[model samples]
Target chain A: MIQFKQATKRYGPTLALDNITITLPENKIIGLFGPNGAGKSTLLKAAAGLVRLSSGNVTVAGKAPRQMRAHLAYLPEQNTLPFAWTIKRAAEFYRAFFADWDEDRYQKQLVMLNLREDMKFGHISKGQLAKARLLLTLARQAHCLLLDEPFSGIDIIARGEITRALVYDYSEGQQTMIISTHEIDEIENLVEHVVFIDSGRAAVFGDADELRCQEGKSIVTIMKEAFRHGSEQVEHV
Target chain B: MDFDATRPIYLQIIDLHKRALMTGELKPRDKILSQRDFAQRYNVNPNTVQRAYREMEALGLVETLRGQGTFIAATEEMLDTMKQDMARSILDSFVQEMKILGFSLQQALELAQEAWQEEESRL
Candidate 1:
């Protein structure tokens, strides 16, 4: 399980994540949803220990992400790759860096995702590159997977296919996945829980089924009605 | 299918259940779509489908046994009740929209007749 205990982060005048207190259950898939500038990326980075927090903390499996770095896999929103690296070379780099890098999985995913080995990072289509990035993330045998906007530029069909593949292939009982994205419909069926954020605060967080029952709408519809009924719109969720 | 946006989505789900039941499209003892299949087909959240199924079960329009798939409620009484419940649920919403459009009894009747004729012509 991952626990965020009043987790707060401040960057000069900006408070990215403010007083977030929640427990994310283990062995389940979670969707982190919000509009733009809602601190979805910041919170994921904080959880991965890629950035420093001004106050409070997050613990994964009873330890901080920095302390449990080896068991965590974080895919940043930005495409992070050596500009000059070939696909095969990048695969080799991942192989050497992570102890649990599965060579068989890496090869299988590369073929399954239809990636070309000779192609450079800059040479592939943006969609293929995104798939490659996700393939690399899944290739790691991590306990927690944090994917920021995995379907940012993909089509609807691919989004569903990718999500289904992730669940069918990578969802070992010990694994936990938290996907942060704005395209809610594509992945709404895949997640067991949901955490909605706006203006750096949690708007709603709980079991997805319970929220649907209470609000009498899908999360997307709830968001729409909430905005239509109010003018202020979420200065703080 | 997307909810029409003017009303709560759960209400639409209830109406869908009734229409399916009444038309014999979804028969009693027939396995209903799984939550995932329902969500994927409609491009909606599985959570929403789960709640819809739960509420349907509570209202006696559907039932689920352990390890068995969910099934539509059987018997003529169950279908009648579902239709009645759906009609009552949407009356206030229809009235409110009609009032907002300044539709009086006679004017609303005229509009309904025209629209119904237009729809029939289309068919």
Candidate 2:
């Protein structure tokens, strides 16, 4: 499980994460959903240990996130690969770095994402870059996966390809996946669990089915309500 | 299968199967797709498909034979009960909606009869 205990992070005057406390269950695809600047990325970065918290702690598999980086695979929102690197070079780099990198899976994803090995990162379109990034991250057999806004800046058809690839390549519930996205409709059917973050705090988190059963509404509907309530709380304070 | 986002996906899968049975799209004793195949077709998690299959088994709509895949149940009693239950639920929702529209039961029945006649004539 990935857990946060009063976890807080600040960037000078801006509070990125504020007193977050939640336990994301293992071996489930969790939808980390919220609007822009709602700290979704902060929560993921904390789990990846890419961003240090100001106070409290973030733990993955019962240990601090920094200690568990070997078991973690994080795909940030931005395309961070060196623009000069070719797709083949990127694959070679991943193969050399991660012990769990599966060459077979990488080859399959390369075909699934329709990526060419000789194409440089700088030459590919934004959508192709997104797919390439996803291909690299998902090629690894990591314990916990943190994907931030994976579908953003991509076309509809590309979105379907990515979604299908994730479903097809999913490690049969052995790996925990937390996909952060503002577009709920795309991932609505894929994620069994959901977490709504607002203003750096967890506004709502639960089994998607239970919430649907109790509220008689979809995840998108419930998320809208949660965000509205969260904003109202902010206004009241 | 068209799915409503308001409900759990597993329940939706069962509903889709039941609908197929009612519409003669799925025959009695016919084998259904494997859980993995169904998950891929629906673009959902395989675990979700497994849960749906389990629920269908519990509802007696399907049976899994060892070393083989799940198949739709062929028993007359089960089919009859499933059909009646589906009709009752649909009628119940229809009546509830008509009541909310301020229509009396008799008036609602009359409207339904007229609508049925028109549909039959179109066919």
Candidate 3:
């Protein structure tokens, strides 16, 4: 389980994450969704221990994200990998860096991404690379998985496979998966929790089913209305 | 399975079930997709799928069993009348739309005749 208590972050003068508070329970696929500039990437990074919180705590499995490094796997929104390295080389790097890396998972991911061992790193399309990243990250069986924009630019069949893989592979009731994406319609069923943040403030965060019951509205509709409501609140300012 | 994206997805799903019943494509007491499978197949929210199922239950289109899945409600005399009346309402709308589209009465009658003949041949 991951707990956020008054978490805060800053980028120069702009506040990226506010003093937000929430508990992300294990065994649930939690979605961090928002419009452009909604600080989704920042929140995912903070949860993944890639960035420091200016205030509050982001603790996973009773430890801070940094302390739980071995158990946490984070894929940033922007791929910082060396473009010069082949897909095989990237997996090889992961195998060398992480002691817990599964060799079978790595090889299976290569096949899933349709990348042969001999394929050049720079030649694959961005969509295929994204699949390769997912094939690597999702197969980890990690205690915590934070994927930033996993659904972006991927086709339908691949998307379905990734979602099913998450549901079947990592649904052990002791693992937590957080996926940040703009496309909610596709993975709405697979997710158990949703956190909608706008302009650095946590707008709505709750169980997916409870939100459906209480709001009596679709997530997409709730998001649009929440943003519109936020705009009106800003207009009064 | 084709439907408009606007409005609520559950509503479209209900509309699909209704069309099946009205057109006799799906019979009374027949089984349809379960909520989970329906949601997975359509790539929509399961809650929406459940809502559609519940709404259908409310409308007497299907009845749910506690452990057993939902089955289409058996045909009723009142429901048959309702379906006929509903069909007339739709036909009235189409006729009104055709009038708005500047189709004359003779043209509309001739087109309907041709469509009837073609539909009969397919049968």
Candidate 4:
């Protein structure tokens, strides 16, 4: 389980994450949703141990994210891999770096995503780049997966491929996943839980189905409604 | 299948199952896809499919045979009743729309009769 107890992170005068507290349970797919600069990335990064918190705490499985690096996989919004490295070479680098890297899963995802092992990172299309990044991220047998904007700047077909790989390759409620994206509809049917953040605060956090039932609307609609009104009804859940 | 965003997905799945049963595409005792397979097929959460299956079970439309799988449990009479229920829902929505369009009950019935005749002629 991922727990945030009044976690706070600051960058000079800007507060990336306010004194936020929320517990994300284990073995469930969660969607971290919000507009740009809504602190969605900060929350995921905090969980991934990529960013330091100013105050309060964030832990996964009773340990800080930095201490749980081997058990976590963080996919950044942009592909930051070396442009000169081929896909296969990138896999080799990952295998050498992360002890939890699963070679078998990497190979399978390569085939499933229709990616070529010899293709260089810079030569592939935007969609292929996205798939390659996902392949690299999911190839690890990490306990917690943080995917930030995996659907951004990708076509529908590539989005479908990513969603399919997420469902078909998931180790069946064993790994906890948090997918942060503004494209809510693409993942509306995929996630069980959602955390809606706006302006460095968690607006709402709860079961996706229950919120849908309550509002008789989709996640996107609920999110809009929550943003239109202040986050009073969903302060910290 | 385009699902309505305003309604819950499980309810939509139940409606789809009912439509299949009413159209004779699924026979009584026929095995439906397992929850995992159904979730993969539709790219939905398995829990959502489970909820839909549970609702169908409560409605006596489907039954799970332990480790075997869920099966269609609707009998002929149940199918007839399901058809009537679907038709009634459609009628109610159409009447509500007609009322919104400033039509009286009698006028809405007459319009519905004309639409039914037109549909029959086309068929």
Q: Chain B TM-score for each model?
A: 0.64, 0.89, 0.76, 0.85
TM-score (C-alpha, index-matched) for candidate 2: 0.91
lDDT tens digits, residue span A88-163, model 2: 9999999999998999999998998899899899998988999999999999999889999999988998999999
Fnat of candidates, each listed: 0.04, 0.75, 0.06, 0.55
Position A46, candidate 1: lDDT:
83
For A157-212, candidate 3 gives per-residue lDDT tens digits of: 77776665454445334667888888887666556677888887777777766666
Please tell me what DockQ candidate 1 reaches: 0.08
Q: How accurate is candidate 3 locally (lDDT)?
A: 0.74
Docking class of 4: acceptable
Per-prediction DockQ scores?
A: 0.08, 0.70, 0.08, 0.44
TM-score of chain A of each: 0.91, 0.96, 0.89, 0.95
Candidate 4, DockQ score (0 to 1): 0.44
RMSD of each: 6.0, 2.9, 7.6, 3.4
Please give the ranking of all candidate structures by TM-score, highest first, separated by commas.
2, 4, 1, 3
Which residue runs does candidate 4 get wrong by more than 4 Å? A96-100, A227-237, B34-36, B54-60, B63-70, B84-115
Model 2 alpha-carbon drift over 4 Å, by segment:
A234-237, B65-67, B94-112
Candidate that beats the other on DockQ, 1 or 2, i.e. the better one: 2
TM-score each candidate: 0.66, 0.91, 0.64, 0.84
Residue pairs clashing, model 1: none
TM-score for the A chain of candidate 2 = 0.96
> Model 3, residue B105: what's the lDDT?
86
Q: lDDT: which candidate is best? A: 2
Better of 1 and 4 by TM-score: 4
- For candidate 3, the TM-score is 0.64
Give the CA lDDT, 0 to 100, for residue A139 in model 3.
Answer: 55
